[model samples]
Target: MNKDNENLVKSYRLLTVWLLSLFILAGIFSVLLIRLDLNLSSKVTTLFWLCFVSFYFISLLLMIYKTERVYYINYITHKEAQQATKEERRAFAYKHLIVFCIATFIFVIYSIVSLIFQYPAAVDFAVFIVIIIVSALRTVPFKLKE
Candidate 1:
């Protein structure tokens, strides 16, 4: 298959998985809300969501950092070899920075909204604070290698 077709298939597969997971999560919450006491349900859901977001957020960052290492290495190598033009390099950097900013903005907004709902865990609040701080660091030009 061509690269385009492969990418399209991968995208659809990812979307399908994401949608299915979201539906399952919603179904779980729905059952909880229906079967449990209102206050108890809120607490349970709050803890579940807090843990879920934290795990996903950490894993997302780790995955991005790992993949970013490959991109950064390729860019550096190509740049030194004069295979990558200055304009192309700048555009690549701009794209990455923009994505980082957007992701940070999204998480910060999610954190804020979650806070407004008053998640019962102090851990959620702390994690959100850390996310905001890390987002602020997204503009740095250095590699985020471990």
Candidate 2:
């Protein structure tokens, strides 16, 4: 395989590992949070959400600026994108879709578990919706300027 194909393969492997690690860590964190039984006051809940939103957006911006260039082919400009084969594009899209599905599954399970444990689950639901919207936007087909 050529350099580009090798890079794409590496990116897929990295993304898979990173996402799996995230899922495990999230599961552990959620279990600990539930077990702690920390009843957060309204003020603390609001502050938690505020901080979550702020950090989430900041991290997203950083990922778009830094990680996408390294791991995502769709981040290229139209001219550069034109050089990529259709198969490459399709493969990348499929990989992204798989990632989205896995993430959605993880979050959905987390939300259900939170509800079952009688923990505050509104944040989990909100995060699930945000993930869906973000994945939808990211997976929208890109048009090349003719």
* Among all candidates shown, the one with the greatest TM-score: 2
Give RMSD to native, each candidate: 10.3, 10.2
Name the regions of candidate 2 deviating beyond 4 angstroms: 1-11, 40-131, 134-146
TM-score, structure 1 vs. true? 0.35
The TM-score values for the models, in the order shown, are 0.35, 0.36
lDDT score of residue 73 within candidate 2: 40
Write candidate 1's Cα lDDT for 69-139 as tens digits: 22332334422313333344345455455555565566556656666786556656566566656754654
lDDT of 1 at 12: 31
Which regions of candidate 1 deviate over 4 angstroms? 1-12, 38-44, 57-146
RMSD to native, candidate 1: 10.3
Candidate 2, poorest ten consecutive residues by summed lDDT: 64-73
